[model samples]
Target: MYGDWSDAPRSLATLGYEPPIPGLIGSSQAMMEVYNLTRRVAGSNASVLLLGETGVGKEMIASAVHRLSQRAAGPFVKVNCGALSESLLESELFGHMRGAFTGAVSNRTGRFEAAHGGSIFLDEINSTSLHLQVKLLRVLQEREFERVGDTQTIRVDTRVVAASNRDLMDEVEAERFREDLYWRLNVVPIRIPPLRERREDIPELVAHFLNVYSETNERHVVHIQREAMEALQDHDWPGNVRELQNYVERAVVLAESDELTVDLLPPEIRSGTKRPPLGMSAQAFDLDTLTQEVVQQGLNEADPDAEDLHSRVVNRVEKELIAQVMQACSGVQTKAATRLGINRNTLHKKLKEYDLDS
Candidate 1:
């Protein structure tokens, strides 16, 4: 799901100093490709659509493209489409004349006019209603729109950069989004991969955030222990880079020394544990035989000369089995009992008798 630097074009490594894309992290081949695509499409006037889950930094990439583009000198405006109601959103995008509605106290310029000769980033554009979508489609097609409660059409020149966490195509298929609007915004599609897909970049991102937070919070923290780093790398960051940035900031603020250690990490991270899939092992089919062999070894160590083989075997296997089930269930005794095909109280009694309660 991630591109290793090894997979990137070898020529890029040797290319004479071109300043790295500002504020956009791209150590992996996947991100480097995004950077390259951004540069390639920067000069064009075509609308761009950035697609990814939340916190994947679609806005940052959009900024990069604008910075490198001819519109670098123009203002960069942004609006969260999903954050406003349909009526308010229309006024926001297309402006409204005085007394356009109950709250329209004065004539207002829309985001389009504010972003003239610049760029307007419509984040979460997929959440717009069909009526709003029609208006957006008209703007994209004619580059002219009428202010609410005004018959005059105002012309504006601005590049549109729309982003969505949802797949616009899927939304269209479900009849929730307009296909024409989808095609209009998706003139140049860019998908930002989630953080978990780029684990190779975690160490660098951690270090970057560590320095940032340390300076901002006046912390002396300068290094992350290898164990702590391994835990960070192994985590599945559902919130992407934003989550990583926040976590590193939290650790830095909580740090008592110059280095981060596993002791300061969250329990899940420090444990680095997950449930093992059922019946998955090196020899899945031979589990019963292996279990018997391990039980026999434990029994011999407990009592080598015991004449009552059945009792000794039963006691040893039961204790070991209970302990293993408890561990695999993460100390949930009820689940352990279910896995063991026994009642919860029976498991509790066994735990007390064998002194494996912990």
Candidate 2:
């Protein structure tokens, strides 16, 4: 955990490395790889498919690609495909004629037309129905599409960058997404790593968010307490950077002093409690059997004359619980912590004490 502002680098530039994308902050190797890929593909006209879990900054990457591309000076239009119905999305993408269906008040230009000579970021493209996918495929291949009610074709010099939180190939296989459209949008696929995969970047992210929220909320919470930083770093962050950003904003708004203390953090973060561990149906996950093993180990290792015998048994029970959750999560610490309903920092400490870190 970062002990002070002096110990944390706010951005890649602060560490003497120029940021590949101006606004991106992380300097971790995982993000470095993503930066490299983004830089390489930004100049090309090929469609980019950003693959990642939700809140992993796919829109940022998409924006970076457009800004770094030849279409920087042109209009940059964005549309969320999953947010609209098939008919509505069709009219949204390709302009609809007046009275196209019923709500077409006037001849309004669509996203592709508005994005002429620029780029269009289609987010949540996987949510598009198969019917809409066919039209999208046409626009990608022909660079032309007709409005919802108009028959005349409209051509545009626009680039497409699509994003999805789900595995598009899985959708393709399941017949939820068109295979042809999948190949079209997947000309360059970039998989954004989740926050848990890049723990080293947490301090920088926390620092950045602290500065942002402090200024926005008129708070002076500049310094982060050591314990608070540790809790932030140890979190599983299943919701990724967006989640971290929200938490930091909350802390800044609630801070009593200039420092962000552990008490300012949410209860689940400080206590490491999420929910009870899920007991998968497997022989090795038999709680009774595991409890017996843990109790036996406790009996052999504990002091014979110790007055805290009950505490020792309780400790053994906790160890067994942690071990079982770890097994159920395939030894993934973040997932195990979440399943065990404990803070990851607490889980890590318990694992080390019980010699279950492996």
Candidate 3:
């Protein structure tokens, strides 16, 4: 899993290589606070703990710290703690000498060693087991470790930067994490606000991702159409910058023209206000997702032995939909029926059948 993470090159912006996107933050007050904290802590070698929801750019912040620090000229290594199994992870982080384990074919360098003289980012660090956390704590305390199969202590200068979406202190309180290690890593804490909290930066982020992905994919897509940008800005961006980058890239690749339009955007973004309106083009009623979601929710909540399960589920969906359309059409039965692509008579019959008629 670690094989897939892209390292933020030291000179991302000034260099021609695609600037690594770590969800750039704009000037929102919450963002400014993060920006200020990052700047203040970047110059120090103290262990840093980045707190935020997933895809909120903790990695980017980590990269920013590495770049702004004295270690900018050295290698920057990254590891996703949640992505590896304990044995494999221990071996991966602390090099496993040949014959250390069955698959230990040869001696290899661990990420910390590779990051010597620079920084090593431990992403999703809260996933580590207490056993490993203790080892990590030891490293932070002594900056010394041995290979998996060897007892000889090897020392290296590596800056430890860690991130987690879950509250580590809560983990500590729950005994899922070691409090000592938490304090060690929490030397400097920085919280990155989710995309929704920094809505003002949406437009600029869209433009930045658009340019980067366009060049990366050699796509001619130039700009986001106004309506598309509006849609983007309206989204809560539950996935944060990573989601935004991926969404933009998808639109860019699919867009036939130079501009990204609402038509090219995902249903979530196209209908920013909520789910796409009931009736749309043959390609866009957007029923599949809505149906699945509602159906899954019903199944999950309903008793398995509930009588007439099929009829009950269908009736619930029909009732909810009719009520929704009726409300959308301001209780105008005819307009609601028209939008629903059904005859007014059938709409009324179903509405009455489901007790949704006024």
Candidate 4:
């Protein structure tokens, strides 16, 4: 599922005055291609659609585009379309007039108006409702829009940089997104590669985060052991760079010496743990070769008509899953709870119940 970047152009590196993309810290071939495309499209007025999984740094790429463009001196505004309701999102993108609705105490300037003469990054644009998408299309096509409850038209020279974790073409096919809007935003599409797709960059990312967290936490953790680095490279980072960053920060804070050893890393990474597929059935998981012996022993001991057998198996699986996620998060309850998709208090109760609190 991953592609090689060995054939990517090296002209920029050969004649480098400074790194082409300053804030992005990857030298992989895939990243180099992204950098090349970003720099190529920066001078134009076209809309840029960034596609990638969450945590792949779309916002960072958007920022780089703005900084490298003619709008470098102008303001850069951002909004998460998926983070707000349709009504609120409408008001957020286009300002609402005073007395427009309940709680509209005073006149407000929305993100579009605030981003005038510069760029506005719409993160998770796939989440916008069709009604909002119509308005967004108008803004993109005409470069003008009126505030909510206002008949007066306002025009601005703002660039649009939209991003989505989903395939917008699929959204359009499903009638969830407007076709015109999709084409309008897809003028210069750039796909940000996930961490697993660019494993070669892991060591660089680790070193960078180590330096950052070390300085922030005033720690002497400057070096990472070879085994630790290998584990980091081997593990599948589902959360991408953000996950790696969190682990590094945790390791730095817990470091007993200047070196980051295997003991300081999360258990899953140190042990090269691989997660089961998201869609794998419980029965299939129980049949895994690694657990077959245990399951068979339990089956041999338990009565065929035991009423608690199912619940017992469920509890055992849940306990082991929680334990692994806990170790992966370095025992941070909040992080573990988030990874497990449970509330913190609920996780605390489970931890105590499973005798994993210690």
Q: What is the C-alpha RMSD of each candidate to the true structure, in Å?
A: 14.6, 12.9, 14.8, 12.1
Residue clash pairs of candidate 1: none
Q: How many Å off is the CA of 115 in candidate 4?
A: 0.5
Give the per-residue lDDT of model 1 (tens digit) for 240-328: 88878887888988899999888877786678774232232321234587578867787667665767877777787778778777776
lDDT of 2 at 231: 87
lDDT of candidate 2? 0.86
Question: What clash pairs does model 2 have?
Answer: 272-342, 272-343, 273-341, 273-342, 273-343, 274-341, 275-341
Which structure is stronger by TM-score: 1 or 4?
Answer: 4
How many pairs collide in each candidate, listed in order?
Answer: 0, 7, 0, 0
TM-score for each model: 0.72, 0.73, 0.68, 0.74
Global lDDT of each candidate: 0.83, 0.86, 0.82, 0.86
For candidate 4, what is the lDDT? 0.86
lDDT tens string, model 4, 176-263?
8899999999999999998888999999899889999999999978888999999999988877888889999999999989999999
Q: Which ten residues in a row have the lowest lDDT in candidate 1?
A: 275-284
lDDT of 2 at 83: 94
Instruction: Report the C-alpha lDDT of model 2 over 241-319, residue by residue, as the tens digit.
Output: 8988999999999898999999989987887654321233441466678788888888888999998988988888897
Error of 1 at 254 (Å): 0.4
Off by over 4 Å in 4: 1-18, 276-358
Q: Lowest-lDDT window of 10 residues in candidate 2? A: 274-283
